[model samples]
Structures are given as C-alpha cells and as structure tokens.
Target: MLPLFPITLAAAALFAPAVAGAAEPQARALQPLMAAEVAAGAPGVTAYVDDGHRVWQGAAGVADVRTGRRLRPTDRFRAGSNTKSMVSTVVLQLVGEHRLALTDTVARRLGPVLPYANRVTVRNLLNHTSGIPDNATPPAVELFKGDPFRRWRPEELVALVADLPQEFPAGSAWNYSNTNYTLLGMMVERSTGHTLAQEVERRILRPLGLRDSSMPLHEPTPSGSFARGYSLDYDDEYNQIPETLRDVTAHDSSGYFAAGNLVTTEADLARFFRALLSGRLLSPALLAEMKTTVPTSYGPGIRYGLGLFFFDDTPCGTLIGHGGGMPGYENQFASTPDGRHQVGIMRNYEEAPDAVTEAQGTLWSKAMELACAA
Candidate 1:
C-alpha cells in the first residue's frame, strides 16, 4: 500500500485465455509514448491494454536498478489499495449470498470491535464513509523502516488507529481510510469459514484463472521477473522531495492485507477489469451498486463508489476501476462499463516531479483513448 499519507488488488475467471493480439504491433504508438516517460527520468514501467479483440503489453526501464534488469509486462507488482476493490467484491458477494448486508453496521457485524461500529454500516466501509481513521499511521511506517520484514496481524492494523478520534460521523462525509477495508477484510474472514485470501481465490482468482495475480499473505517480496520498488520523500501534494531515494522492495505485506496486498501482472490486472466491466463478475443490480457514486475529496467532480472509482470524464466513456501503490510500485487501471476498452499501468518508483506525474497521467489517458479507438 502506498502510504494514506503512509498506508495501503481484482477480478474474474471468464476471459483468462491467451492474448488475442500481437503486443508490439498493437502498442506501436504507446511504446514510444511510455518510453518518453522513462526518458523523463522515471523508473522502470510496465503496462497492459485490451481493446475487446486484442490485448497489448509493454515495458520500459529497469526492473532491478542494481542489475539493470529490463522491466517486463509479465512481472508482478505489490499493488497497494487496489486490493480494496477485491475485498469489497467479496463483501458484496456475501451480501448477495444473504450472508451479509450493505446496511449491516460494524457493531452488528464485528460487534463493537470499533467504537463507531454501530453507526458505520458495511456500505460505509465499502464507500469510505465510515468515518474511521486510517491505521497506516506515520509510526507504523517508522516501524516498517526499522524492520521492513515485520509481520502484522489484521487486528493489529486496526488497533494502530482505533483509539484515535473518528474522522467524521458515519455516512456523513467522505475520507479515504485504509482501516475501513481492513475491518471489511476481517469481516470477510469471519463471515466466510475461510481466510480472506482463500475466499478471494475461490471466488475471483481461481475462476478468472489469474495465475499471475496473488494475495501474498506471507511473502515479503515478489520473485520471478518482478520490478523492484523504491521510495523517496514526497510533499503533501506528492511532488518529489529531491534527492531522497531509497530501495523499498522488501517488506512484510500483512500490514496491507486485504486493504492492498495483491501481487499481479499488468495483463492479468487488465483482464480482470475487462471481465468485470463486461458483466462477467456479478449480477446487474450488484454491479450497479458497486458503481453507485458519492462525491470524494479528490476534487468536486471526482467520485467514488463501493470499492470502485468513477472516472466519468475519461477517454473511454466513464471508465470504472481503481489504482494503488506503496513505496516501490504504483498501478492504475480502469475500463468502460461495458468492458470494450481497458488499460493497466505499472510503475516501479514513486514521487516523481509534478510534470512527470501529470505527463504519465496524460499519456495513460491517451493510451486508453488509443485502445478504445483501436
């Protein structure tokens, strides 16, 4: 999980077959477009796109700076809060099964594990209106820096900020909090007779055949053709604090848990989004509920749904999905509601200059536009 100031993975089993398109030919324009970002001094990058018929994957820069390993599209990443979307999906599945309800209060579900549980509904946790403060506090990060491999239990994550004041009254305002999803993760485990990872695997991963995607509940770092993530100081606005780079690829992932402890490749991530938006994951009514929107502090026009983000003004006609990163890796992905177009971007470093970040966003937007048109 890229740090809430310092804090804190998706989809299905239907269309997880071989690639339909030639990657290089499909990404001709996109290749150089992303290459320019690498030229602009960003770290190694990997990406994937699906335009219904064909899929394209591309990469630039080194996955391992020490060895100068070229980043590959198949490499896995520690996708941070993007894990919220999956956790929320499992919760909604439970709801569909009559095992859980959106209106069920935390107090009703977790039974007073939190002070405001009675007032915070399951919907609140999914939509970030729970008013619960985040647990990925500055101190936890400090502890992480001291011992990057320290294991964390789900309960310990919530306890970190449990005593703090509530962010707001339940269902009153919107604030992104990692703790909400952590509770939902706990709820998933308790409601199902299995761990959160097992439930996700049973429901989403295995069915979708997302071989490259995993909930590494125990692994500290990724293996295989994985890109190494690095860290640097960033200002409140997330602009780079120059000259503060640190290798941050190794760390225990339990702190992120369901909040965002996914390890997946760009193609696998894009495939899940494609299946999800194409109406392969859930019932129509539940999918609609997932896309239900509430205003977010990201900006006046920006909005969030239950574990899903609404990019209403995007190039691909209101693409809906999520993005996540922690110290070493960042990922952003979205697809049109009908799943006609999709894109997944992977980055190996954080806190670049504002221009670089904006440029990356623009290029990403263009990639989606190109993918849609292709």
Candidate 2:
C-alpha cells in the first residue's frame, strides 16, 4: 500500500494573508458568489474585489489535496491567456516610446522566418485577426507529447507555425491563434532587444508594483505556495486516461510564452485589472483604441478588442475582461466600464465542465449588480 502523509498547513498559512479591511456587510454579500463557485466542484478558488477605496479578498476550498492544504489569497496560479493583456500593455508601451507602431507589419521586425509576417500588422496580431495558424494545434500537441519538458526557444517555436498556411487572409477575418502572440513575443524581443519577461517587468509589472506576478520561462512550478492540478480519470477501452495527480511545477512555460505564460496571485490580478481600467498603463486615447471591437464568429454578441474580450451585459451594463484555461487551471478577471469594481477568480481543477466559465459570467453579473446598486 502507498504510504499516506498529511498535507502541510504551513505553506497555506504562509501564502494567505489576513483580509486587510473586509467589512461585514460586503463579506456577507459575497457569500453567495463563493458558495456558487464551490458547488461547481472547484478544488480551490481565490477571489479579489476592489470597490474604489477598500479591497475585499476571499478564498475557499483546497489548494493541494494531497497535502490537505487550503487555498490562500496569496497563492499563485497560472494566468493562462490573461498573459495577453500584459503582452499588449508592453507593446503599447513601445508605441508610446515611438519604438514600434501598431501599423508596422510583423515581417519588418521578424523578417522571412514567419510565413504571414509580411501581411499581418502588429495591430492584427494584438487583435487576433492576423490569420496566422495557432501554434497550439495538432503539430504543437505532437511536439509537446514527444518532449513535454523540453525548453524551447522562441524562434524554434515560431518555426513550427512559420510554414503553415494562413488560416485566412491577413486582417480579413478573426481567429484566436496562439501563433499571433508567439510571433508578437518574438517581435517584442527583436524590436526592444529584450525578452518578453524583461519587457513586461520594465513596462508594466515594475510600474504597477505587482510584486507577486512573474513571467516564469521554463522554470519549475511556482514557488512558495500554489494549488496542485489533477486530471480526471478515464477508461482505457474508451481511450480515457485515469485521473492522475502531479506537481504542476514541471510544466514548460515555453509552450505558453507570450500568449499565456504568466503566473500570479488573485490580488495581483485584481491590481492589474484595476490599473488597466484606470488608464494607468495606456494613454486615454490608446485605452479607447484598445476597447474598440471587431466582430468574430466565436459567439453571438461576443467581440474581440485589443488584448481583451467585450461582452454585453444583460440589464446590468457592459463589461470587459478575459478568461483562460490549461489542462488543470481556469481563471477569469473582469471589471466594470468605469473600473470602479473588479472581480478575479482562479481555480485549481479544470475537470468541471463549463463550470468555471459559467461561474465567471455569473460572478461578473453579481458584481455588476452589486456595484450598480451601491
């Protein structure tokens, strides 16, 4: 029999800090939202809400089941596509510096290596209309299966999609291709002579003082405290793999790179959303440009903004934010139009079908209702 060990609580305590100034009224009101998320079967969750002056943060469930650890507010989790917002911020900073223009074609920066580089502009890549084939397609799956732990260079990863036929004519349509941002990552390096992580740090992280956020490239799973991810069980006859548990620390950040390779805590994410909505990262004009929408087939009433998603609210009001998922992680960060109130949630297990997405939308709606009432 396998030996059983009690999970450590020290890590949990170290990561979660006491709620600085949570008010009784607000904390009681947030109970429904937390209960809904927990009923959805999430192993762990962290939520942060900022209503102008004071910030309210809460956590529920477990971060590491094997260690019997509970989720903490400060525990870091994969941000998945939330990284795009950060990347876009850096790109916009370069524009502010006059180092690169949104109109510049990628080929001007990356040269002959990228197949559609000549046709796609920097703006197209940022908005996901470049029509570049997504690197996360079958070819990328094969590469990962063969060498899940290999550290990949940006160029080598770009080359994988460089020769693939364009998904559509450049700038003619929209598609959520990871390749666009992978190329954007390379372009950032080429244009600024700095890696994506370094550029993000200098332009956004440091300026915002987001101390807990990091762009770990091929590093081990996040240090200090974090949730352990699990895959659901499957039957062999059905070609289903058994539910397995593993330390997510060994996963390669290279595969995500600029597109989805960020790790951060809920408070850090709330800060990012708040700063972005407040126009701290971009000029007012640029922020307006970033919020403009382009039609896409992904969903009815769904549109793509520059590095953000535009969703029409029902009876409440319009909201903007992004959602991301990996094998074992799902996250959402959203805020109101005026940036007065923001909600961020991260969960460890991805096994729940559409639960995370549904919970996110529900949470956003609840937040909007609460904010508008106040």
Candidate 3:
C-alpha cells in the first residue's frame, strides 16, 4: 500500500512541486523521497514519471556544490551505460533491414583486427555474453583519473583490453563489459560507413523527437543547464583519500565512447524506452529477440536482454530498462512491460555514502509503487 497521507491527488502533486508547470500525483511521492536521498549524501537527484497521460518530474538537492545551485528536473546529465540501448536499437534496425545478422562473427564483420574479434558474435556483444573484459583497468583509470578532458580514440580505448585474457569463454558466462558495446559501436560504424553518433541520431534520436539527447563525441560537459557531477574519489581499498568530493562534470565522455557517452534528460530517456518497448522502434520479432534474457551477473531478479534489462521480481511485476553508471553519475530508467508506466532517476554524485544508496533503493521501491499504480 502507498503511504496514505490523507492528501488529495492535486495536493500530492504539490508535495515536491513539478518542473513542467503542472504536476501529477503519481510523481508526488518521489520529491521528498529524492530529498531524503540528498540529505543522505547524494549531491542531487532528478526524476520523472509518465503515467500514460501526462509526465511529471521532480528534482532535489544542488546541481553544483560550489555555488549551491538547486538541481532542476529540466537539467540534462550523462546517461552513462544507458547509451547501450540506443546503440543496440540502431544495430537491430540494421539487422531488421538485413544489413547485419546477430549471428555474424565480429571478425567476419570487422575484418578481424582484434585477436578475440573472430570468436565473439554480434549477439554475444549485445547481451554481454562475450567474454570481453572491461577496458577500465587500473592502469587506464590511473592514467585518466586526474585528466578528465583528454580525448581518447576508439581504437585506443579498445586496444586497452583486446589482448587481455577473456573473463570466460564466449557464451559460457555473463559479465558486464563496456568493451563489448564499444566493439559493437565499431561494428555499427564499419557496417554503415558512418559514425555511431550519426547513425544513432539518424535512426533513433531524430525519429523519436528526443531533442534533449545527444551522443557527445568530444564534449566534456553537457550543454545547457546541466547538473554538475561529483565523485568522492575513493581508493581501491574503499577508503576516502581526499575526504571531499571533486567536481567531475567536465570529464570527457569520449573515453566512454559508444559504450556510455549519451547525454539525456529523464523525460527523453522515458520516451525512448517507451517507444522501444511499444514496438515502434523495432519489429515484433526483433523486439522479442531483444527481450530474450540471460542472467546478469549483477543480481537475482535482474536479467540482461540484448540491450535492455528485465526486472520481473520487482513489486511492479516485469519492467524493462537499463541502469547506468559513470564516474560521477548513477542513473536508472524503467518502464512497465507494455510501456504504459515509466520512471527515470538520476543522482549527480558517484562514490557517495552508503546511506545514499539506501535512499536511492527506497526511490526504486517508490518507482515500483508508481508503476504498479499506473
């Protein structure tokens, strides 16, 4: 049961206030919940919920710690690994057009430049069944940690892990590897003879009218009024070395590249996932293929599909969307199986206090409540 507050829906809409001028009661529960997250140690949080008819959004805490600027729901933030879904959508569209096949080996598609490319399949890359180890090794992190504005070439990024031992034999196990999608991005570029950003804009963003989203090729910061991302700069031993957070909003997302370089707002993310799940983005057959699940090594009740995740054991029954993390942001967007109800949440700080994670978990529970109600 939702926490009964004896307030009417309209009054509830005023609980945290809405950003888009009008507020929905369905979104009321999130405002204070987000506030609690901020109080618990998150620098800021912005969230939106679409309950079929209208979209309601809320923000909590500061966008910048230096000036103490309030975070707004309208502000854009890095979507992080959520970019994978957009990339996968473009790849699937090509597959639908008969330009590529999921079974096509990476070596066959890209001419076997990398040693492990021939052994990995396109489908393996999409579902993370490929044993490509993540490229964010300690050396890479040490090299880039203080130099956030450095531009990284895609080949250089892929070369970091191409020669490393596989995490497991291809298709034998599951481990989340950003390198898999980075390779997929290369494949998309090779297959289409266009940049991955160009293909995504032409195929997904423009078609969906996601005006607030973009693939940041070299920009280190989001355009417009964007939240300033922060990191606690914890060490490998989980010890807080600096005892203070650093502003990381200007870090070059080009390092993440096709794996997680997307800059988007909560509303735009909600819209994209809604369209993807509604059969408006991919064919019914491909959409089904996209939803086919393999156990994500992350946790139980969570399964990785081609590019999306299915959470069936949640209070909202089955919902599909992906959660993303970068150096300074942790975000999630989930929608009902049929795309009727959707929610997105963003926290502007990573490596935050444990209480922040607990507060965010509470927000997830609230999201389930809102989705189930919808």
The prediction achieving the highest TM-score against the true structure is: 3
What TM-scores do the predictions have? 0.88, 0.85, 0.90
Candidate 2 per-residue C-alpha lDDT over 18-74 given as tens digits, one digit per residue, 9 for 90 to 100: 343455444566556655665555556666766655567777667766655777778
Measure candidate 1: CA RMSD: 6.5
Per-residue accuracy of model 3 over 119-220 as CA lDDT, tens digit each: 889999999999988876532364234465667877887788867888888999999988888888988898899999999999999999999999977786
The 10-residue segment of model 2 with minimum total lDDT is 1-10
Candidate 3 lands at a TM-score of: 0.90
lDDT of 3: 0.79
True-structure RMSD for candidate 3: 6.8
lDDT of each: 0.75, 0.70, 0.79
Candidate 3 ranges beyond 4 A from true positions: 1-24, 138-144, 234-239
Candidate 2 TM-score over all chains jointly: 0.85
**Each model's total of backbone clashes:** 14, 5, 0
* Greater-lDDT candidate between 1 and 2: 1
- Clash pairs, model 2 backbone: 7-67, 221-249, 232-243, 233-243, 234-241
